[model samples]
Target: MPYIKKDFIERLIDRVDIVDVIGARLTLKRSGSSYMCCCPFHNEKTPSFSVSQQKQFYNCFGCHKSGNVLGFIMDYDQLSFPEAVEQLAKEAGVQVEYEESAGHAPEKKEREVDFYDILERAALLFEAELPRHPEALKYLHDRGLSDDTLRRYHVGFAPESWDYLIKNLAGDNQKILKAMTDLGLVNQGQQGKVYDTFRNRVIIPIRDKRGRTIAFGGRVLDNSKPKYINSRESPVYKKGHELFNLDAIRNLRDKNLPYIMITEGYMDVIALEQAGIHNAVASLGTATTPEQMNLLFKQADRIIFCYDGDAAGRNAAWHALNTALPALSDDKQLQFCFLPPEHDPDTLVRSQGAKAMLDYLEHAESLPEYIIATLRNQYNVDDEGGRINCIDRAAEILSLMPDAILTRAAVEKRLADLVGWSQEGLHGSIDDSIEKLRARKAVRGPESTGAGGSGSRMDPNTIPLNPMRAVVARLVKDPELMRAIPEPDKLVAVLREYANDRCQVLLDLMGKIKANPDTTTGALLEKYRDSGKIGDLISLLAARSDAAIEEEGFVEIKIIDLMHYIKAILQEHLTARKQALRIKGRREGGLSNEELIEVQFLETATRQLQPSRKS
Candidate 1:
């Protein structure tokens, strides 16, 4: 990936009016200097999403999703970091400049912009061609698609001729042809010859949540060896990264869809929509992927994967279940609905009705139920040995649930019942498995000395009650607060008394702020954008600080409190050292002159630190 220059990103953020950027997508009501609305990341009745116009950041009290304009666009629009930057720059009327890095050509960025335009142009051409091809229209109409549904989904037909798109889109422009080739719209053969990638197939354009045409899915008109072919992975499109018709689903006004259904193909999605079931998406011709599951869960809390009841469909559903295991949480859910053996979502909805299909969904098997059924079919729970195997496998699978509290407890209880064991026994077994999994995931790498880089050591004790963490979090959210400290150098010296990785991080951050006084919170975090665990810890602390210090001058008071706390800790250390030396002097008839001098110095420092205790 090409690196966008830090200076350029900071400038783009400064120039962006966050209100205008977010307001264009969501309705914003001003609440003092910040704007408030129901968070787009989660469902809620009351407004908890607060956007600070002064700070140029957003924090949601409900879901706790907070970030600057770049993060908001990335999350709400489902765009990658680079894509978010590009889109924001365009909206801010600024041209994005990248820092030169090895192995990355300058033209790759230009190619990316060209890919979006070319894909969109291809969608338009295909939509225009749909009217010209009666056979394609007949195929769609025979499948019970209404004219409104076809137009709404941008359903089109690729001409049977191999050079149809090549002629219409590229013509004789070699540059456009190469770009189309890169975007998977055209194939370049051995002789540098280019041909249309989709031909004689009905094209259903696949889009992102932003409604940009990123790729296309094409289906054959008759019986063919491969019934469908989608655009290959390109700079703009990843196969498993997007779900078909999600753009429409996100745009729905309700925002309270009971569930989002996942199907296997583009036609299934289109047919289901034509049946008036608007909350369905397809996995773009691949088995459900973890990335797809994340996208689905973001739209709605519950996901119902609708698949055919054949052996292949069951296998696909199983793959989906495994993919969804690690992402399971209390707020998110997964269920499986299998259609009749002779039918898929398309055929089932067409034959019975939308209500019948919905009934099948209403009775979908949950994650635990599906897991237990699969295990039961695989092993005989009636036998003692088989029961033991079932217990072991159940423990392993249940350990993948990430939430170690509520979600884990509920799922564990379900598994325990299936295995006919006490919940305590199953809990111990899953606890062991979770520990082993964590052990396997513990990877070792070179240690980092800087807080703004990956592999930096972050002390676990630096969280929750650490006054130093609160100090760092405050400074991170507002670097200008560094000026409130009386003598920052002396404070750094005091912090160093702790001699831990977190203190080192604070030292590094203080130095950065001292050198760059005008830095904003967004810009400061951008410096540690890739600082792995340490970066995450700092952001978490900063959020806590934001929630705590809302009063005027309270932040300054917090900094002062931390300073006093550190001074007290250092004073206690000095007093302890003086007592230890005095004990040594008593133990050995008399101390050396150097030892006596050290004790005198410690006593003087302790007296100066705590005058109230002085006699």
Candidate 2:
């Protein structure tokens, strides 16, 4: 891949509106010189996060977290450095420009620069092929899809001929051939030859949030076990990360909407669209993934899972809900809507008009209600033993949801009244089960938002206390001040014990700031966002203390004094360690070579760093 020019990045940053970007995720109130919001990074009742439009930066009075537009997005959306830049650039409507650096290695598909263009051409090819296939068109028409709907969705077809696409779209160009293969549109056989991946099927284009055609799904004409086959995971397209018709609904997506409808197939999504329900999309031939759910929550406040009424549909709904439960935020909602037995969205919409389908969604069962009802159906609650079993099952599933959905107190009171068990007894039993569930799921990884990004239920006690809060807060809020201190290496050594989370990030950051004197705080933070808990730890530290001296000119003087204090602390630690080791060696037999070397080195390093003390 070509190197993205720093000039392009600088221009992109200059072009974006900080308020617009930050305001999208949060509500910002205008103050005298800045905007303020309750910092999303931490749990705070009072507003402390401040964004200064004049300086093109932000600093929290409570957390001391600070950066420009990119940093805010990286924190808010859990996006990596390049991802944030591209997203902001897209919002700003500025094209990303790249250049080749000398001796830089090219990506495998680097020469194939027109991946999106090729995908568009393939989509059009399928469209052009559809008109000739009367049987394919008839199948769609029989499903009650109007010509206008067909055109709007860009639904298409593929012929059974082995080399139809290869001959039509890919000629003699090896680069185009590789691009097609990369997209999984062309499959390689035993003889090292390529053949069309989709054949004798109705083609549906799968798109990204950006509306780009990243992959395709094809439905078989004849009855088959796997009625529909989708494109394999490619560089640009992963089934778990995308949804069918997401491109259609994304523009119509309104965050204020109570919930967006999630369907199981492309046809269902198109059916919903034809019925004038614009806030509906479907996962691409796979179970809904946490990443896709994260993307969905970014657009809407709630999600409604619409499944078929058959046993298969019920299983699909449960699988989706279970996969999505850990990622659900307290503020968001999820619901379920089922069609009649043997009925799917396409058939249901065709049989009864859009209004009838809308009625089902309008009265969709909420998650908690469904959980209770499903529990009752699964366990016989007429006896004492049955009630206990039912409660245990409920706890397992409910543990996946956050306290926002159903609190332990609410569960206790509700279960005691409903199940005829003592409130205290039931609460204690359920708490034990839920703790087991959390322990089992501790390693499943975090959700795609906030500082932790791990959407596991947050507890205030989990955040560590910052003993050197002021020094650490200054580094994050005003990174350039690190250079002003004469003893950064010693300062880091002294403060490492306090930063239990990704302390090496602090060390790496200081080194980078020292190397490139011109690196901005936002750029510096972006470099280490994915290294570990660096960004989260900094955000936590920022939330721990108020920004004492966040102003530009005055920060250096403050750092100079702080550095001397930290250096003195480092000396004390070193002297104390040496004395302890010496005493230990004398007590035992004599000094081990390693222990003696460490003591001597610490003493010498302490002497060298001592002379530059501010006093």
Candidate 3:
């Protein structure tokens, strides 16, 4: 990757409106000179995340994550460096110039913006047809959907004619056909003839979180061979990565107490939303993906999966549960609700009303209860062989979960009751599962380390005060200390050059401060408006009640400790570098006499610089 110039990054940061960017994702209320919102990264009742429009940076006093606009985009959207830069540039209305000969040109694809633009146009054309087309209107009305719901979902219709879209768009026939084919709106025959992929079908435009129309799903007006047809995976659309009705629900999230209600079909989502249950979303055509789970995690803390009380729904719930384990933290939760065996969300809301549906959700079976019930129905535990197989299968599934002692204990107790195993025997089985998990983690190696030596494996729930972190924290709290450092430029340079993980975000903020000496904390915080973690970092620093006063205070102690920490870090790097030299010598058909002497000299330098263990 071509190195992104610091000046370009700084310019991009300057151009962005931090409040506008962050306000899009979170609800912000003005507090003095800053804006406060509940930290979106963690479940917090209080507004710990502060956005400083003046500083152009954001920091969560609760969580110590700080960064600028680019950092905010990367964290909030889960975008890469280039993606975040591109997004910020778009937001700032700045066109990024690139040199083709500099090896930095974005790899061009034949189907680029034009494809998505065409799809958007196609969606609009389909949407226009909804009100006029009798079959489409009847299909929705028959499903108990209202005009408000249809418009909210941008429901549309694709006419049955093969050339309806192609001819009306007034583009080259071949190019139009190719665009339709690319979007999976039409099929190209062997002879290069074009035809409609969705005929007399109600179209639902599928958009990403950015609210750009990326794909479409069509449902036939009548009983058809294929019940629904969705756009194929293109440069833009991945069905598993998206959830239907997300665009609609996201709009209403601020006013309502957002709770994710997962239904089985697109119409089910529409029906529920029509009934004033606006916090509902659905899977595309298949089971939920981890990507979908992450998206849900962003909007709401509590997720209730409302599926039909049938075998298939139960199986889907199980799959969704497994997919969510890695992503779901203690703060985030998953609940399960099943409608009557024959009734879907649409039928339930229509028959019992929205109030009854909400009541059912509140009283629905817990995930564990649903899992146990599903297992018992699938396998007869009274049969000895069946019981053994069930226990083994349950153990395999439970082993996949991360360390959650209370939840694990509850699951184990339930498993023992179902299998009729003694508590002691079940304890042994749980231990076996834990050991397997540990072995797998060991094989995967340690979590990657950040530039500041903070390991990625460190849980966000537990904030540790290691020496390096203490140094960074002190710098964060007292920007004056930055001036006192002997080689401030070298220190900042090393931090920026080496730290590309979470810690790099901090380095970026520090770099900005160095560039503009007059930059204020409030401005810095606003710049990182999208970084919930940055707000957390600020909260962490601000929450420290003890002040450092010369030699007697926390500041002095931490500063002295930081100096030693820097020495230790340098020693570690030197030792690692020497080891690399030795390995290189062996790889080059054995070291020459001079090379061996030089290796010894390097080792001597490393040993000489090692920090005192007592410090």
Candidate 4:
């Protein structure tokens, strides 16, 4: 097989449970919401190796080794990344799809072997030559890179001589020379002459997700004209799709951090990693692309783009935001962090420390905030014409967001507040804008349409209805009760209708419980400990635990009743919205075509939700 397809790996991983995988190898005793065993990698009397079934991850607190199932397999079984993947696929009883078929694989395999071998060999040569160059060694050392960091990243130096790589690696072999040229290690000049492409520069190899060296980036040692020289795009390397240090960051066990830090260059990633921030990656010396954004999303649910707090950086960030519009979803988050004018990620981390860098990242401007701020700076919201312009521009951008009801509604509400427009009026205008966007896209060509949903809530309805809050609290007391919730998607849709803070937490908690059937209350509490709501969760459980103790199976029964109540509320809300639309149609002459369709959808949904409880 050439390489295992990414989607196949993802599916295979999703099928296999971490508890089963680790329990089969090591005796895991239940410990709260996780399992515990003495770490196989380290000698310790205490069990420091903890496995979170909910997270599908393992961490050895003693030895500092932590990763997901695939990572554990790689470390424990002494297997390569591909071997671990194969092992999991076999256990999961799934067929692994390669990028190439067996009949056509041999040629591709040979090319891959040759290409990777050449890149690796070139990296080794540069590594060996680094110690011989005092200036290069000093430059890295002075910049706070330790011996371990340098070795870990495989940092190297390409000698000043133009023929260093060609003379050592390619020699007089025509095939080898051609391969090197194709790989961008050597370049062909005037009159068929050839020389090393990265002469007298610091070489850092860029590896793929599989940890295979595919390309190199070289930065100059002095104040040179072009400060950096990266390998030209070759068959093995595509710039837009790859992020520097991605292979390293993927090994992180807690990859689901609230946000992943996205930097602008290799050194920034390297510096951040060296500073004890392992959850960061760089966009490879270019504006972040849609493909890059998608890749980041696959790794984590959120991203915070870090850039200099300058005009150029703002421009670059604006481009990234526009590129990311199509990929926005209610489940995903995007933020931006603009650094001080004098510093990039590298300098900031070095000057202040990791804590400072993290503080900045944690407080980055969210996507909606950034959008509104950018518009506010560009337009005079006080003037009618300017406010109208802001509304129009906001509609165009907001319309590009995936048609998720709650997220769109939340953002549109913000826009409405800013432009002093009634929610009804703004909704109508945005619906029209959505149509125009689709019509224009239709004229151009076929493109993927996003999921759609309705937004806003009942005017007199108080959020976190006693039933909703009770359900969440009881689920916290007995997480398995989450399985009793029928039509979870619809349930989430209903919770999102309110868009309250408590509802957000409820939505996230319900999602986690649904994801893991074996979810325990302790594990649930652990997940929220850092969310600053642990005290509230504990209080909720304390206040409601007696009812569960007084009656057996009360939690599950109560959960079902609450779910019915929530759905009934949804039915009522939809009816009210539908009636409101009709009244607006009569008052404002007639509803738009989109509003007419929405009215019909609401009617159907409300009818379907007509109280089915047997009580």
Model 1 lDDT, full chain set: 0.78
lDDT of 4 by residue, 1-615 (tens): 377776676666667888999898889999866799997654468997888776565666554455567767766654556778888888788877888767768866546438788899999999999999999999999899999999999999998899988888878887788889888888887888888899889999999866889999999888886999899999788899789977776665233355688888999989988999988889877788877776676566688999999999999888998888777665678899999999999999999999999899888998878887898898898999998888888888877776764667877888888888899999999888778877877877755211100111112112344545656666665566667776778668755763444466667777878877675543454345334444344323422323343345465567766667566556656777788899999999999999999888887888787855796
lDDT of model 4 at position 54: 61
Cα lDDT tens digits for candidate 2, 1-615: 566667687767656668888888789998755689987654468998887664466666654556668877765655656777788988888777866555454662375458888889999999888989999999888887888988897889989978877887788877788888988899999999789999999998887766788889999877875788889998788788777776665565433455789988888888878887778888877888988887777666678999988888888888888888876665567889988887888788878988989899988987766777677777778888999899888788768766645533544566677677788888788889988878887799653565535344233224654324445555655666766776666566554743334345556666777776655545544455555565666555433333345443565567765575455556666677778888998899888898889878878967975865576
Among these predicted structures, which one has the highest TM-score? 1
Tell how far residue 388 is off in model 2, in angstroms: 3.7
TM-score of 1: 0.86
The true-versus-predicted C-alpha distance at residue 278 of model 1, in Å, is 0.9
TM-scores for candidates 1 onward, in order: 0.86, 0.77, 0.75, 0.59
Clashing pairs in 2: 63-542, 63-543, 446-454, 447-454, 447-455
Candidate 1, 27-118: lDDT as tens digits: 99988557899887777889988877666667777666666788788778777788899999998888889877665666555555567788
Q: Rank the candidates by TM-score, best first.
A: 1, 2, 3, 4
For model 3, the stretches where C-alpha displacement exceeds 4 angstroms are: 1-7, 14-36, 50-57, 61-67, 74-87, 98-113, 173-177, 256-258, 383-387, 420-425, 437-482, 487-615
